[model samples]
Target: MVFYALGSKFIQEKKDRENTPPKAQEVIYYSLAIGHHLGVIDCLKPQITCKVAEYDAWIAQLPIDGEARRKLEGVKRFGEINIDGTHTHLLAVALHHSLPQMTEQQQQWSRELIALLQRMENEPAIYLLVRRHDDW
Candidate 1:
């Protein structure tokens, strides 16, 4: 009885594998897989610096002070986009850098900033002159 059930389960799993969906979209700046599921195989894998001066105005309006404010002023650099589709998927919080490169402190800052931005009716859209791309 046990063998029979095991065989049936194995067959079902094989059938399921045959029908799995294609891979989900990849993370913007890295090989991180965001939406992969049952069918796709798991291939596990594995910054410049800049100053804050250019962003002075944008930072002034942030409503943050002290360390939080200082860190924002200290970021050196973020990316080198050599991979496909990698140019677009970075977490807005990490700049153009991959998620893994984000330090624990940075992560905390991201969360806090995200929360703060969420509350500001217009802050998220505010442009950062320092950013090379869009205003923000």
Candidate 2:
């Protein structure tokens, strides 16, 4: 899961560098989505870094090809896993990042969401399920 997140971040950076859009649109989309999931994980486990730089270095060695991109697209489309409340989790992270200036109500909501995420992250089964990615 950590590797997927780091790889996705690397891919997003690669895509951002190109002036033209990536030929594999689905790959880019799924990369960003997975990266977002990583962000949520980071929020839950603030102390965990997962050697992201090492993962990025390893990901740089991989070749991006049509077949791989198609597989990623298929995983994104056909994978049965459903992640609920991701939007709310994202919103909480966003609000937390925007702290100090955020309204009291927003801050309270962010704290509540973070608490809920912490609980979810503590569940061994949920953690195992979320960490599994068929595309990898």
Candidate 3:
């Protein structure tokens, strides 16, 4: 479900890039990365052993610079040690970048995504699932 939402946003961002300013495009890229990280946390399953591979595929498709790439690499590393904390930090950074320029609808979606992240943060089962995998 989260993945679907992320995919939709990614498509929209791609389409919007033509009209978007360079700085705003950077925000969009960060937002996509944050969304992907959240999607990974949401999609974790005990039977799945290829989560890191999935993440790598997604990362490879992103058109980000070295700094953004490093930030995402940090997301993967920190997620292994602390999924909730890492997600919170990444989401906050993405939001800070994107919020000032977002349309009302975009802001609403961001709010919903933030709520979802908060809910997931409180789920111990999700944390355990994250810890069970080191492939990331």
Candidate 4:
């Protein structure tokens, strides 16, 4: 009789556990959709652009779990994509402005960026490819 009650209770608890949803991971991928949209040229210009510092500060402020924090640190080691004003400006223009809004040259730049992102998605590892390509 006692064994039957215990077995039923265990089954009920198992069902409850199975019904519960898993916790969400805290680290979010920074993207244009999330308002992390930084300009390539703007990022490139360190002297004039505080975006990298600002982003770092923002990340520090988030209340993330230890796993997410570790992942973010890994991401930070890659450094800001822009060390010069030129790349920062180019990235910014590509992400924020429409082709119609840009001059012909800038439109071409946007097309290149779109292609790059698509290619990156298909590649097995973006960081590995980028590091190798950059000789970093």
Candidate 5:
């Protein structure tokens, strides 16, 4: 959310984390949602963080049991895709850098973002490839 708010130079990235444990994901979300307090000497650049800690705290306290509560207890990161500002600007930027060999269309690329980047990363792929690409 805040990343796109910063600007429009985003490129899609894919990762496979099929075996990542739930606790690790929870810790990541908690870190983002409840952002760290900056030191006075720190730089003032805008930080990208989920603005949903209060809601998450409330949800965590609800009367629920077992996996349901555990899932909610995992911090829920929130994002709102700026349909006009971010998406439109991204479309324009991509078109500006478009190649003659590529079929660039705003209609194809400008769909409203509908889910968390983390969720997209963890989703099972429709097809699997044996080749491995190392990220690190």
Candidate 6:
């Protein structure tokens, strides 16, 4: 189980380093897988980050392809994306950079992962819209 988690991170990092457009999408997916394995979906929450708008703006800058963008669309909850077909890595990166304050139940390993990523300067812009991409 632990190795699975580590493997996910390794794959994510490898993709991130590639920094190509398609590779960015791959990084987003693999990172989310790692995030899910690490239980980040359960740890971060709607109320944690006051800067959802900022985070959303940052995410918007990434050249997310149509499929990945569509995957990220139509979500009402942060955790929902984990099961709703949105890329997990993108979700994890969003939570990490958003600096959301977690609930008591969520203050655990996930938080540590977010903090660690943040420490590594993995900052990106985020986009928050009232509706979906249509609202943008």
State which candidate has the highest TM-score: 3
Model 2: colliding residue pairs: none
> lDDT for each of the candidates?
0.29, 0.36, 0.45, 0.31, 0.28, 0.38
Off by over 4 Å in 3: 1-85, 127-136
RMSD of each predicted structure:
18.6, 17.4, 17.2, 20.7, 18.1, 13.5
Alpha-carbon deviation at 67 in model 3, angstroms: 7.3
lDDT of 6: 0.38
Q: Which residue pairs clash in candidate 3? A: none
- Model 1, 121: alpha-carbon shift in Å? 3.6
lDDT (10s digit) by residue, model 3, range 1-62 = 01222223333544666787877767754554454447554433332233565545433432
Off by over 4 Å in 5: 1-16, 36-136
TM-score of 2: 0.26
TM per candidate: 0.22, 0.26, 0.32, 0.26, 0.20, 0.24
Tens digits of lDDT, candidate 6, 21-108: 7666666655554564565544222322323454344335334554434444434343234322223465455545443454432344
| Residue-wise C-alpha lDDT for candidate 2, range 6-97, written one tens digit per residue | 22233334446475355555565454445444654442222112233332332232234433223213323543223333333443454455
**Residue 34, candidate 5: how far off, in angstroms?**
2.0
Candidate 3 worst ten-residue window by lDDT: 1-10
Say which prediction, candidate 1 or candidate 5, comes out ahead on TM-score.
Answer: 1
Better of 2 and 3 by TM-score: 3
How big is the positional error of residue 111 in model 2, measured in Å on the Cα after superposition? 0.4
Error of 3 at 60 (Å): 16
Decoy 1 TM-score against native:
0.22
Q: Which ten residues in a row are the worst by lDDT in model 2? A: 123-132
Total clashes for model 4: 20
Candidate 4, residue 65: CA error in Å? 27
